[model samples]
Target: MINDIGDLLTNLLFATKKIIPVAIKQSIKDTIYALISIPKTKIYVFRLNKIISDHKKVKGYIIYPPTLDWDYMFQRPQQLARQFAKNGYLFFFCNKSYKSRGFKEVEPNIVTCGADTRKSLSAINDVIVYISWAGHINFFRKLKYTKLIYDYLDSLKVADSKGKGLFKKHIRLVANADLVLVTSDILHKKLLLEGRIKKTILVPNACDFKHFNIKKTINKNFEDINLIVNKNKPIIGYSGAFAEWFDYSLIKYCIKKRPNYEFVLLGATIGSSFHRSILDFPNVNYLGEKRYKVLPYYISCFDVAILPFKINDITRSTSPVKIFEYMASGKPVISTNLPECKKYKIILVSRGKKDFVNNIDRGLGLSRNKNYILKTQMLAKRNTWDKRFNLISKYL
Candidate 1:
């Protein structure tokens, strides 16, 4: 009886261990599915801005899937909505969560669908185009539209591990679109390789320079520097999301090699390990996240700025707004060698860790000149959001 009881106990323990791992794996899978489904669930906001403001009268309707509340994503839609309102066009934004947030009243031009079945979309004018994939796929496919535009912001298959299914959906949408607006040259090229016949246009990411340039001064007080480096020491700063594409390991190497320079990272921590490494560094200062308007002050404080992006599908196609912002601040810059940035000789490009270190050293040693400042300012002037919007306006 004792032997039989021991065998049963051992078998129970083995089963429990196996079951726990399976449960954990299933939980992770559910979380990832929820994240990916976000874009499908929230398609109303993006479409409304596109259709509302191009003309005095609303000619069409636009649709967008729900997107993550990243600063970059939210700011564009909000800005577009404001622009559309200024143009006096009817706009409607819909989301499943809007009702839960106590948003019941439909404002002048804006309509809130709340969590209603998307069947209401059928009543929308067939003269207007409908857009979206995945969650809105069935709706869009069934719609008979005058014109459809698919905005491909990123090549999801290559850029995100969890977005492979979404990428396939995008391909189908692209085939269905009357026009395809690609956000990167790389994405455009990829579509061309796939023999996509859609009318494709490249529209790189943009920044609101006027907003960033607000209340610019030669000086601003930052307290974080005193504990990490000398107050008057030359500051080399980087700001943005600390994601996997960021080469923090390269940053770590460079900071270790150069003790004289202060490295300021102004963004949320990506991982605990990265956060610990950065905080432990004597010369490194992590200032967490800051308001968008406050970024210019931090940029102004930097003697030089760095864009250390890891070479991946995401970074390869990425046209970082910070590059233009750094230029706008009239600070000399060093960045990793990226194809999109290769056209601009204004930025110092580094191939690897050794090259990055060397470039930063060179940039630090260079004398700041009025001519250099003026040139950078000129570049910044040309790259402003208004100019980019004008180019986009041509297509509209």
Candidate 2:
């Protein structure tokens, strides 16, 4: 009963964005929220301690620190949690908002639960608590567990997205983590330079090959895309966030140069970084974000896939999952020379606007080459979430 009330105040501090001031640090908000619910916290701690006393015989348990809601755009947190559950660990992916949804069993071993969830569990002795967001530092003490792993997926240098205050949390998480998993070599190298490489491992992003490489024909349910894709012109496509880091200038150049090519975009305009003026062009089509299930159907329609991201510290650390999804679909991919993208030789790394546009034309021919298709698909098949889990499990 007490656990239920804590769930209301626990994730609500971060989840209910309109209620909380944007200027306040999430850690402070969460800390204050936890403090207010001391009675609830005591109950949760008692329940957890009682479970330890019982000595229940279970394999293990995995808990993800509260982040995005489970139903939101499926991302690394959800993907990795699924993998852990598949391996027999009872996994929980906590949400940051919509606590009213209650505890939802997403799969056989996996469930998405609301915050302050001591009622749901019977044990905490054999537990692994995984965290990606530095803001979750506030919950560290409250989440007493057997192991704590910090997945350093993104850089803290991107100042706009709570970087300044969270930087301190990053240091604390990295310093105290049982194991650290970095998604890219640049991140692994960063840890090395800082002399924090003792417990870090590189487990880069991967694709679900069987999911992306569709065997059956996709139904023509996407009525809106029919308006954009033309038989006369080739389709150059992109998916993922339309954020501040996206290279709008390069895409603008590509759109103007190839007037015949139809450019289709998927994903949401994150904050105010995306200017609507570019969408006004006749050839450019912004269809908004599709369900993750039907995302491949949209990708399969592309003659070429692109990652028009600004080469910055944030991108350098990012292992673009969309790039692999495009590869899995046997589509030729082009991108600005992000270190992660540049690692793959097949991905046409563009130096400047002219070269980026030129690559789109090259990609048209590359799409026809059966050998190119086979190699790209094979690369995607090789790097599955299952394989990524195998690497991570060894360290755990």
Candidate 3:
């Protein structure tokens, strides 16, 4: 009778264990539904959902498209934001989509705002510097800022939706800004034509020298060197996004001419019919997007770095970060004659298929020369992000 009682108790405990979780899960679901049914909670969530800003007062630099904070490339906005934060200023990165609300601290001094932040322009304290890209002109214009800086990061008129009147908005932004920063000479001239010549300053893109300057010790310590880097043939590499501006036909031509040269393209390729043809080439290799930290290892193995970009309105104003990065890696760069590339005398500028093919040979020859490598490295050292930041500091 005691053994039967023990078995009954054991079975009852086993049943209780199984029943408890199901009951708890049901209770949670019921509670969630009950909470959602409350009108005040729904209203609170709606307001919270719309806030996408850090309501911080500490000498902020407002950057539109908060996603730039996470970009591995650390473009102009992110680079400057980090420098500003390091110098005792709180950096507030505003998301482009102002639809939902919350704020996240992505870094020690950098705060990213979500869509739901309810802080008004007046409520935000110590916001002295306001810088914005072309797209966020109207959105940030209303904010009361002491110094309005318009950073023309790109030629928005050519890049954005054609019928959205974005360029028109850009005009108003230029006129309103206390200072205007253009990335290229083409942009500088454009701003001059708009009669904001005095305010416009050409602040070209720069590189993080320490990051890309891969030392000899790094090569020895790198374990994945043999796995990812192609050591068989002379590696001609290109890093950065393969967007519409990338000259695919020139890349195809280069592969056909120099079958002995192994061309490696890195970064995510935007969907294009031309991609399949380029990948089909036996001499060509595509190693998908790599983290910024490991990029130096790949670049270290390169014989020549290239910037084969199409000559168009988009390329005209682009001061490529890759050129500086390639130089910092101490590699010779063969590039098309984009306006910005021409400024760097170290770069071998190619104008056509014949020129492109010839410069690749010239670049390959230059890469082997120790003096040439040092020259390129010197150029990069001078144009470091810190140097760029110093120039920006004068205006502030």
The candidate scoring highest on lDDT is 2
Model 2, residue 218: C-alpha shift (Å): 5.2
Question: What is the lDDT of every predicted structure here?
Answer: 0.63, 0.81, 0.73
Clashes of each: 6, 0, 17
- For each candidate in turn, the TM-score is 0.71, 0.83, 0.79
Residue lDDT tens for model 2, 141-208: 56547788999998876534647878778888989899999999998998899889988999999988
Which of the two candidates, 1 or 2, achieves a greater TM-score against the reference?
2
lDDT of 3 by residue, 2-75 (tens): 34554565555556776667677566555555555555434434543333233344455544443333444546
Model 3 spans > 4 angstroms off? 1-69, 96-101, 118-122, 128-132, 161-164, 216-230, 271-274
- Candidate 2's C-alpha runs over 4 A off are 1-58, 98-100, 116-123, 158-162, 215-218, 230-232
* CA RMSD of all predictions: 14.5, 10.6, 8.4
Q: Judge candidate 1 at residue 220 and give its lDDT.
A: 28
Clashes of 3: 17
